[model samples]
Target: MTEFDLIVFGGGTGNRVASAAAEAGMETALIEKGPIGGLCLNRGCNPSKMLIQHATVANRVREASRFGIDASIDDVHFRGFVREVNDELAAVADRKAQDKRDQVNLTLFQEEARFVDDRTIELVESGETHTGEEVVVASGSTPVVPDSIDGIDEVDFLTSADALRLETSPERLVVLGGGYIAAELGYYFDAFGTDVALIDRNETLLHREDADVARAFTEVAEERHDVYTGHSATAVDESNGEFVVTAETEEGGSVEVTGDELLVVLGRRPNTDGVGLDATNIETDDRGFVATDDRLRTSVDGVWAMGDVAGNAMFKHTGDYEGEIVVDNVVHDAGREVDFTALPHAVFTEPQVAAVGRTEAELDKSGTEYVVGRAAFTDTAMSRALKLDRGFVKVLCDLESRAVVGCHVFGHEASILVHEAVPAVRYGLTVDDLANTLLHAHPALSKLVQKACADAVDAADRTTE
Candidate 1:
């Protein structure tokens, strides 16, 4: 048995906590079965965005005709392009691992770890036992393939990770699920000239997004791919070198989609089961996520859980935020609550979607009174110059406090533009505060935000009158 000052399971955001402790002169053990950077770097955000950039460039070239520029894509070199992305990412992972190994007080365990007790862990491959004064389980998440789908085990289906690593675009693709992962991956292949069909149980793609944004995105997606909303995938099977998916619609009709490849993007499941939490008597939510207090501490003393395993927001940025909180509490005993206020997320698809804070649906359901402000891209000079036909920004402000509660945007550079509202939502800034701050650049996309804030201020004034 070996003893360490700190032990962290999963090298995702947990790497941050472990590195911090090691730098503090405490012996730290980081057990990561895969690469050091975790899912975001290995398979989730980094790889997906890198590959999506190729799609984005291809799309821009294809759409250049609208700007009166004679642009054409001679060839995509899809296989070589994917290989380059993978090679670059693999090199990054290698560098990360080597850096961690070089850390004076950090031991990088490239092997699986399971809890033997509250503070004891057993390395699976080495059959070695290690105990620590403090432990953090940041086991992240895995892609969920619904067992409810008949023959799901029979037909080989590509997960979000597999889809990102594809060397060649499929002739035709069938995508099951309609959340952000589904939207992003399906759009990538479609932009690469794949015949993509998306099926979802909800009435619209990105149904979790604001209703207006979802509706608008679905309309645009339908123009690019065969979108079958309100349809739940029932079964999958492969025959004669093609895969077929059968789904049941809300109206009780059956629809079958056949494609060269089937991509499943149902969602992600917590890796709670992989870690031996049962031995420690640590509490888990009904959905099997490690239940933690606001400080991210688990039921066991000196133990913490963060990231996807804690069942908070599953984005990499969220995990990073939570990681910082955990380290502060563990090292400095800061006792700070994990503040997810104005947590932002972006979908990297065409006409990208981005949002922060509460959604209109949540406010309405909670019976919270709020006023909305809206602005379309067509109303902006920059958008007109770029020939952008669709996209808009929607902001919701509390009726009483007049502070921005939620902001949703859909447009070119939506991801970047959404930051204008993030500080407002985070600091409880009012619409007037945003609109009256400064002179926005003329004929810029940011004017869309300025216009929306102005509209919000007007809406609030009307509410008082």
Candidate 2:
């Protein structure tokens, strides 16, 4: 049996933790089942954004006629686009792996790891036993494929993993989920001249978002794709070379959608099961996600769980943030706890969506008194100059304390503008505090946020008067 100061179960975010431990003078080992760089770099965010950016260029030129510019997308060369992103990501993974292998104090185990006991693991491929004084599981997550849909088992379908790797855009693409992944890739293909259809059980495309924002996005999405909301996919079948999906409509009738390819973005499951969690004292919730304290330490002593496996937050930025906390607490013995008071989420689809802090539904469910404010992008000089037709910025603040609790945006660069709301939400700035303190340049998207906040404040002042 080989022993190390620390053994990490994944090389994805574990790469960061392992490197930090080694730098802090502890010998570390990182075991990975897949390639280095993990989901975010290889499959999820980076590569998806790469394709999305190209599609954005195509979409911009296609819409440029609105600005009186003669612009058109002659050819997408989609196969070359996929190849470029994939090859670049692969090179990145290779470089990171080689760098880890070169580290004197960090050993890279290019294999799967399963728990032997509470403090030990077996490298599955080599049958090697390894022990650690401290252990961390950053194994991340995998796409969820349900077997409930009849005939789905036999048909060839693509998930987000496969969608990002396609060299050729399908003649017609059918998407199975209405969340961020489905919205993003569905829009991307639509921009590239591929016929796209979206079928979702939810009534809105981004069901988690506020009703107005969700409605706005669905409206925009409908303009570009065949959107079948409130439809649940029941089964998949193939006729000739095309794929057919039978779904149950909201009104209880059956409908069929035919497409050249099917892309499933229903959801993701944590990579906790089959990881030997049963062998350890590590407790998991009903969803198989590791149950961790605020500090991110697993129930097992000297063990920590983070990223998707821990079920705290699923974003890449969340993983990196928690990884830093884990490194500080374990390596430096800092005793730092995670406070996700202002974590932000963004979907990079056209007319991007972003949100920070508690959603209005949560506030209503809790019976929390709040203020609502809204501003449309069309009211802004910049949006008018750009001839942008849609988008809104909204803010909610506590009625008594005047603290801004939530903010949501739907517009161009909404992802970037959402960050401005983060500090206000995190630090508990009031509507008046934000509206009065911040200086937004004229004709800039930043002013939209201040306008929303000022709207709320003005409404409150009127009520008082």
Candidate 3:
């Protein structure tokens, strides 16, 4: 049996913790199965965003005439683009491996790790056992393919991972999810001239988002794709080289969605299977996510878990933040805690969406006294300048603190624009604080943020009696 000061399982963002431990002069060993950068770099976030950016450019040029400028996309080498991204990711993975090689205090085990005991991990291939003074389970998540659906063995279907590597866009694609993944990838392929159809069990797309935002996005999305909401896909069948999904809606009717390919992106499950958690006391939740406290601790001693496995927030940025928290607690022996007050997320589909803090639905559910301020781009000065006909920004304020408790945006570059609202919610900035301190430039997208803040202020001061 071999040993180290620290042992980290999972290669993705877990590498961050390994780096921190190594820098602290601790002998760190990182156990990974082949790729180094985890899901975000390899398949999930970075590569998907890159592909979506190309689709955005392509669609923008195709619709440039709306801005009174004539432009068009004649041809797109979709396969080559995917190949280029994969190649770049390969180079990135190589660089990460080289960095690991350069580190003298860290050992990289390019193999799968399973828990042998609370403190010991055994490699799957060589049966090599290794123990650590401190063990960190950073193994992330994997896309879920449920067994409830029928005809899985008969036909070939694509998961989000498979869809990301597709070289050619099919003539028609049927997507089986309504979350951010479905919205983003569906938009990407649809922009590339694929006839995309979206089927969701929920009545609205992006069910996790604010209801108003979800409805608005669904309304706009329907204009481009065949949208079937309140539809549960019961059976999937393949015939004549096409996939036909039979979905039963709550209104007592069955609808068939046909496409050359089926993309299933229902949700993700934590990668805890076969890792031998039974040998240890690492308690998992009902949904199989590792349980962690505010300081990213497990029930067992000398063992910690973070990232998607911890289920704090699924985004890679959140994983990195969690890694820092673990680094502070483990490497530096500091009792730092995680504060996810104003964590932000985005869906880069058309009529893009970005949100931070609580939704209005959440506030109402909790009986929080709050006022909402909303501004549509169509009603703004910059809308006409940029030829934007859709999108809005909504802000929620707590009555007592007058602080911006939540901010949601649905418009152009909402992801970038949402950062402006992040600080307001994160630092507990009041509407008056924003209005009194910040001045937005004229004829810019940021003006909408300014208007939203101002509106929140006015709405808050009104007498309800």
Model 1, residue 233: distance off in Å is 0.7
Give lDDT tens digits, candidate 2, residues 47-73.
999899999988788788887899866
What TM-score does candidate 3 reach? 0.97
Candidate 1 clashing pairs, residues 3+ apart or interchain: none
Candidate 1 residue-wise lDDT, 52-155, digit = tens = 99999999898898878999988879999899988898999999899899999999999988999989999999999999999999999998988999999998
Model 2 misplacement above 4 A: none
After superposing candidate 1, which stretches have Cα over 4 Å from the reference?
Answer: none
Error of 1 at 423 (Å): 1.2
What is candidate 3's CA lDDT for residue 266? 90
Per-residue lDDT of 144 in model 2: 86
The C-alpha local distance difference test score for the whole of candidate 2 amounts to 0.90
Candidate ordering by lDDT (highest first): 1, 2, 3
**lDDT for each residue of candidate 3 in 217-288, tens digit (9 for 90 to 100):** 999889989999999888899988999999898888999899999999999989887688988888999989
When 1 and 3 are scored with TM-score, the better candidate is 1
Residue 204 in candidate 3 has what lDDT?
A: 97
Candidate 3 residue pairs in clash (backbone atoms < 3 Å)? 12-38
Q: What TM-score does prediction 1 earn? A: 0.98
